[model samples]
Target: MNKSVPANVTIVDHPLVQVKLTQMRRKETISSDFRRLLKEISLLLAYEVTRDLALTEREIETPIERAMFPVLRDREPCFISILRAGNGILDGMMDLLPSARVGHVGLYRDHETLEAVEYYYKVPSDIADREVIVVDPMLATGHTAVAAIERLKKDGAKNLKFLCLLAAPEGIAEFHKGHPDVPVFTASVDKKLNEHGYIVPGLGDAGDRIYGTK
Candidate 1:
């Protein structure tokens, strides 16, 4: 619908993310290692994503002396993992920001219509007051991801971010067209979507790979 996605959308090209992404893409990678690498890469990506988070000074006593130290503002960020595939990224982001609250949103794309249909949705206590990040592995077509963000906005989340391991240009455009105010952070943007809607030269079905299913 809309073609204007944020030019600022970062495709984290860090060498470590690239290396881990390569491992995740291999067909031989087992669920255990897949999950582990996803977690590690997610954490690394989170580090870059949170670089601009607001911080405040707080008085703390170190082993040596008492001084004011910069800490994440008293505010706690909230994370929403789009079910199944998103959970892999969730593990990593959680490991990085243990203090952040968590939520889950589940949606299934209809086999025939290819339309997103929500199955489950749950969020933190007061999402309006906190920064919210939605994690999903692939941003293809952007139908489900955009729908997810619409639900989050309806629920009161003012600040939002979308995190994905890989994204296609078409999907990214669709997403930003709908929510231009929100920013997306992703590991890499592959070439283009094939006729079947899979990203070309892209990692295969993320949900299947992460959970060890077909």
Candidate 2:
């Protein structure tokens, strides 16, 4: 069977995103610097992820002139962080969208089973009525992202988008299979996953690198 990257996937190939991504991928990069890079790149990624936020025109006064300006139609999106690594992206996104509601899903992949296991979950009561942006730095096997989205949808999150720093082809395929309606925005799609389910040529364990837990 022929395979393809999902049509809903958007690659954010902006120059700054690519450059910071390279820095984060380097083994010699210190954890502090890696965390800094992740946050910086995440802001760039968030800019693209929120590009389609609803807009409305409202009357406003600009200095000596009265005119209509395009403003957000509603509250900022509700953001769900997939876990510890997800927080790295969340911080940057919050910087960009200060009014965005924040939530956390403490989901992790079982090392041996390669399945997502959720330990914690919380979100705004109005998640169903607002757009949801799910952030995680890496999408390796995709189980984590799938599980997180499943939880959100179960909670009535109708409009959702997945944002990640890097993704593997296998991961994207798996994610699409489970949630084809949700669009994915990522800085780059790498080659493949290695035997242990790590994205090939990907930055090392995002959570570990971000928190210096390794």
Best by lDDT: 2
Give residue 183's error in model 2 in angstroms: 0.7
Candidate 2 lDDT, 1-214, residue by residue in tens: 1135678999998999989999999999999999899889989999999998989999999899999999999877999998889999988889998999999999978999999999998899999989999999888899999999999999999999999998999999999999999999999899999999998899889999988898
Estimate the lDDT of model 1: 0.87
**Where is model 1 more than 4 Å wrong at Cα?**
1-6
Q: Alpha carbon lDDT of residue 131, candidate 2?
A: 93
Model 1, 1-214: lDDT tens per residue? 1233368687787999999999988888988998899999999989888878999999999999999999988478898999979999988888888999999999977767667899999898799999999999999878889999999999999889999998989888889889988899988887788877787778888998888888
Residue 3 local lDDT, model 1: 30
TM-score of 1: 0.94
Q: TM-score each candidate.
A: 0.94, 0.96
Q: List ranges where model 2 is wrong by over 4 Å.
A: 1-4
lDDT score of residue 120 within candidate 2: 96
